[model samples]
Target: MRYGEATVTVVDPRSYMTYQPFLPEAAAGSISPRHVVVPLRRVLPKAEVLTGRVTTIDQDRKVATIAPLVGEAYELPFDYLVIAMGAVSRTFPIPGLAEQGIGMKGIEEAIGLRNHVLEQLDKADSTNDEEVRRKALTFVFVGGGFAGAETIGEVEDMARDAAKYYTNVSREDMRFILVDAADKILPEVGPKLGAYGKEHLESRGVEVYLSTSMDSCVDGHVVLKNGLEVDSSTIVWTAGVKPNPVLSRFGLPLGPRGHVDTQATLQVQGTDYIWAAGDNAQVPDVAARKAGVENAWCPPNAQHALRQARVLGDNVISGMRGFPQKEYAHANKGAVAGLGLHKGVAMIVMGKMKIKLKGRLAWYMHRSYHGFAMPTWNRKIRVFADWTLAVFLKREVVSLGAIETPREEFYEAAKPAPKVAQSAEAQLPPTRAKSEEKAKAS
Candidate 1:
């Protein structure tokens, strides 16, 4: 943008981009919800930020169809297009999963999950019915990846804290189940750390099911392939994610797994004017290639996305200025995940040495790493403050489920009162009745 060679425009369905790494903490009420997102307009004041979704793109005509949140759809023309549209949750046609399963993708879903979990606890505490209490107390999370594991871990911790306030529902009464198709969880960190994470959760009384798949979740009656069936009120689906389906509508060349195929330069294959990155692009890992591996691609993580964005931005500028484009090449920096309050796992690679950390130190590492990685000083400060407060203060156990229907009270209050009509007999005075009686007597 500083080059003044081109007018930049960023089109997205949301006005803000959520930092997904902090979602677990956000869900667990460790951080304020608003601090998790960075407003595009605030960050990029010069770039035109369109609060709408791109429905289709006709590269032949260099025009994309954008449908706003409201009203009719319109076409947007561009000289050069950057497809950083990101990815969506990958789901299958599983019976009852769509109707009953909850997702943990967006900010709204994170907040909703927090509220829903607390609401379930409230239901369990207030109810005497065995079935209702059991269902409310049972929480199932499919996918033992970072999103699934971290969420269940944090929410379970929050629920434990909340149980102290409840006379009826105790921590032992609640059942937290985590199911994964893979043999190990937290594959981002090595197998040993992953095994430890699973063990840690199990020690906390969380049921860890490995190499098992959920057959169905019809009406929240979860049936696993391993012959385990549970009627749960909350079923969180964080299984996995694929490239956004909208990418198919753009008439762009896609990979076998449905991601935009991009060269090392981050530009869409067979097209010079179009560029793609993030979870939607199958970016080549130059480090892997140099390490004598063939066709190795970068994993879909915040670390890769952050680095890719910088290189993509620089390449865009270079393209506009007719300068040589540099390929994105960065070695893996390992992975870190927080499992509730003081429990976490971190694998940091420094040169050839791999450092494995767990417990409180790993938890601090997780916070410090994310706090620095978060975009904008304003957001960074707020996130750091949340961590600081968490050290001094206990986790907030209250749930604002009413926030979803905040206007309900106002709506009820604004309703007009009922009108009552007076009958003619009631309107007559006692004197009129006596006069009528005297006339009759006369």
Candidate 2:
């Protein structure tokens, strides 16, 4: 029945779907990196999984051009289309941003961030240069959304715990600055919870800057619009995300902001068989509209994306057959964010009642909710195990930045090619060479 009866092909450069909610914890080393992603092949065995990119789609001919990892590109034909390319980090043309800023988009970035933060502590503790030490200990995070707030919080917690292992490095020796153009951070949790989050971070000695933005990060020098200048070695960019630009090439009706326009039913506005969801689709909030709210749209969060996927899939099956399509409508359950260990903010909506929580209880709720929400039982168990193990074990704070360029050390130690050696006769004088040969023969 469902998608099994019809042929399905999934094209993506990555073979797994990354559970992005756990990325902050993964970067903080609270969860294993391997457990934060679900393998696509294992999850979708019925579909033909291709580890490549769908470069273009020909809706008229019903063909898609795919560029594989290690081969020439090819065209794939399909009947019903599902556009779920997702989104990429939104960035700007800020000076030196591309060269110096670190992102928090994927698992690889999380791993790199962990290593980099720990390595900064190591460098600060060992260096005699005060300038270098100060720069090493300073961290700047831009954006105050879930990604920025949670990441800085978790990373700060990690660095604080990691400081104990070093002789000279301590919490006071480090500086963490958070910047957001918005008036409050974590706006999804409501203004009260957002204020609580800001105060919580500040009480823990983090510098919170609201209504401020970074002007430039050129040459490791951070210049803020409010006239704050500092040299920071670690600059984290988690501003926001925009829909993948590739969607523009898909020949579909798109919204003003470049998202594919779709009805509440999750089907593309004009197309009958094609469907799009997740961060790439501009889906109207039907549930909100019925509540008398106007121009409401689903936020680009995992909470809405997961629900939309289910609706889109059902709509696809209904289109394949002659059944009617159901419109997707669900109110937001709530929002929970983990700041550091034993610290967070949450707002839970049960039917018509809304409950607000903060501090240790909120942190627990954050972990519990995200742990259960992680895709697959295997990952769920592994994430819980990682947390349980942390209770009895000390935090691992070693920097293995070599993992990025794994073969660099080998290249440095490798010997050069052997030089050609001349024969003894060739080295001898012209007259003595033949004479010495004749004597040796005799």
Candidate 3:
């Protein structure tokens, strides 16, 4: 049943290779977006990595109907399937969200956010209109998790630096807000570190709203559940993510949160061939079981995902060749997050010891760890080059919003004419008529 190198199809809707740990750095201009993402094709050269959304699956026939980016949907048969489709940004049905706020999920969003922030600064500087300037200078970020906290921090740092170059705009005029429903931020790094992060952000003039949720962001007018109202132009939504709902359509058993149910060996429950990993699978935490927990599942993070992927790959080979499969188990390997340049927090769990770091040292550790963890040598060099060049050259602040619609301007400039040109057929030549009559007589 096994094909050569095995036809392993990793179904991720987004084709970009996301080294998510560097997203903050990318947003902050510390690293380039090009450096943060690797092409999935280059990495998974052997496997048939299909970049498309899975509309539905027939588990009995082992065929998945996929809708690719272009063209029509088609059915692909597979002997073994791996579900690593990952999670999508989660947003509640808040009024005006669709009209305004941007979510930080993929590279496009990150780059768009960076450009929008810089463009806001430009707008503030170019216009003497006080109302427009005020609106342009205000930035609001919802959710206090790693994405929200880090994105706002990096953006604030960039904006502050950029203000120095602008004659009219000053850092004092710009307002930044961080809103979260939870009382604390960065829960993965523990409570004490979360408190430290909040303080660090507040020290930089960011208004922190705890135990508050956004009611609406209609027409750039923000209404919070705490009865506060503010009119701002930029709103960022980083309010966590749920598993891709496509799993439910497959007719497979899904967990409470819509993740596929998988055994400790990373194989789908009751199936011999199918395997799941990454953010999409609810893999049992055997370590938690040994520690007397009733039922615990692996948390969805890159640290766990990378390890699970290796185990899943090995398990596929083992299952096909009649070798023993190993159970996937790993203890939490701490967490590190950069608040801004030279400011970060870290908690390392080594054996029985739990070591924590903060400030510049933690920042260094954050960069160092992620630098080594980025996919390949080519990406590692590009990231380092970005850092090296950043020391001498300023971060590119121009926003190519037009990149999405490059042809719009050209099409408008070259409008089509309504009338057609006159041809020789419109004037029946006398010589041609005579020649046709002579031929008919002959």
Candidate 4:
């Protein structure tokens, strides 16, 4: 934000800002989902973005409403508010998971999970129906943290390099699976680097399971609360995240899970012209309560929301120059993930010393620390030119699932224009054309 004093604006519904750890290398096509987002009018050129969707928030009339993205619902009028709406997809009504899961947060769910895992490897390579080719090569990931173990280790390494231009879909006819109720997986990269990222995604075949849980999948069948059963026509759902429940009508003071309860100078606690930080705010982890820890907070990550967004924009410009605010603190600096091309897992931490890395030097320090934490340099030179054109191109592996039905072939070429072939007395039916005109007038 090229901080031009005051007058900011910034509503949202994606004017762009994703950069979500490069959404598993943009679902393993190796980073290109439009360089993983960041536009907001080219990084807030003096703010005022407004894509829209605030839908109500009075706070005793500081006003808010907004809705736009294409029409009515207005209002706005702020003085300082800023909650940072983030988080959703916590899911678990688990019975076909709201019509079959598949979520990765955004960037249109990582380009619809990489065109639905390469259209389930092109329906398991032109299906001959071995149970629809094992339910289109079964995928099924379900959160093991670090977004379901770096998205089933970069979609099982992009379906094992797209089963080498599939003939009948090789890579041992793909499966992947993953599921987790948390017995351990990336546990924030600790426990021996989360058991070396669960033995490097179980040495690439993937299956994992850990403490399991998934009692239903419905139509695509799966079952699992330990009883196991499968079917899987893809499934995904990186299982975690909550906060953005539109902040329950925004009146503020949220906490015990809904978030926005700030204070550690990110304001909001009793409102000081309002303010908040990432993952929808719940602040107060001031260096884990000065290390005594006990009930500490600040963990909805992104490295403590990038240092609570530079101490909530220098405490909203020092509460508009009345000054004195700056509290937010930080203490951990380690955890990289990558798991695909070259594979990964890292840890760095400084003060108490840590350093643990694994494989391809933790995948080149997870792509040079998320390509210098991508966000301008024009999306870090388009994510380092999509990792230098994925080093000599090739891995595109196709499947743009028709970009999710773009007007479905123009609604099947705007059908209904083929009804002009009805001659023969319009297919004869008016009393057989008056009994063939009285047998052609006898």
Quick one: ranking by TM-score, best first? 2, 1, 3, 4
Runs off by more than 4 Å, candidate 4: 1-22, 25-61, 68-71, 76-80, 85-113, 116-156, 159-161, 168-264, 267-271, 279-301, 306-326, 350-352, 360-403, 406-414, 426-436, 440-442
The local distance difference test score of each candidate is 0.91, 0.93, 0.88, 0.84
Ranking by lDDT: 2, 1, 3, 4
Q: Write the per-residue lDDT of candidate 1 for residues 1-442, one digit (tens) a residue.
A: 6557678878888899999989998999999999999999999988888889888888889998989999999998998899987888888899998888888889999999999999999998888899999999999999999999899989999999999999998999999999999999999999999999999999999999999999998888999989999999999999999998878878888999999999999999998888888999999999989989999998888899999999998998888778988899999988999999999999999988999999989998998999999999999999999988888888887789999999999989998988888877567799997887798999
Better of 1 and 3 by lDDT: 1
Give TM per candidate.
0.94, 0.96, 0.91, 0.38
Compared to the true structure, candidate 1 yields what TM-score? 0.94
Query: Which residue runs does candidate 1 get wrong by more than 4 Å?
Result: 1-4, 416-442
The CA lDDT at 261 in model 3 is 95
lDDT of 2 by residue, 266-375 (tens): 99998898999999999999989999999999999989999998988888989988799999898989999999889999999998899999999999999999999888
Off by over 4 Å in 3: 1-5, 417-442
- Lowest lDDT 10-residue stretch of candidate 4: 1-10
Instruction: Give a tens-digit lDDT track for model 3, residues 1-442.
Output: 3446556677667776888777777777788888889888888787677788889888889898989988999998888777888888888999999889898878878888888888898889899899999999999999999889988888899898888889999999999999999999999999999999999999999999999999999999999999989889999999998998878888877898899999999988888888899998999998878878879999988889999989988898899888988999988889999898788999999977889899999988887888888999999999988878987898766667777688999998898966877665555588887787798999
How many backbone clashes does every candidate have?
0, 0, 0, 0
Question: Given candidate 4, what's the lDDT at residue 215?
Answer: 86
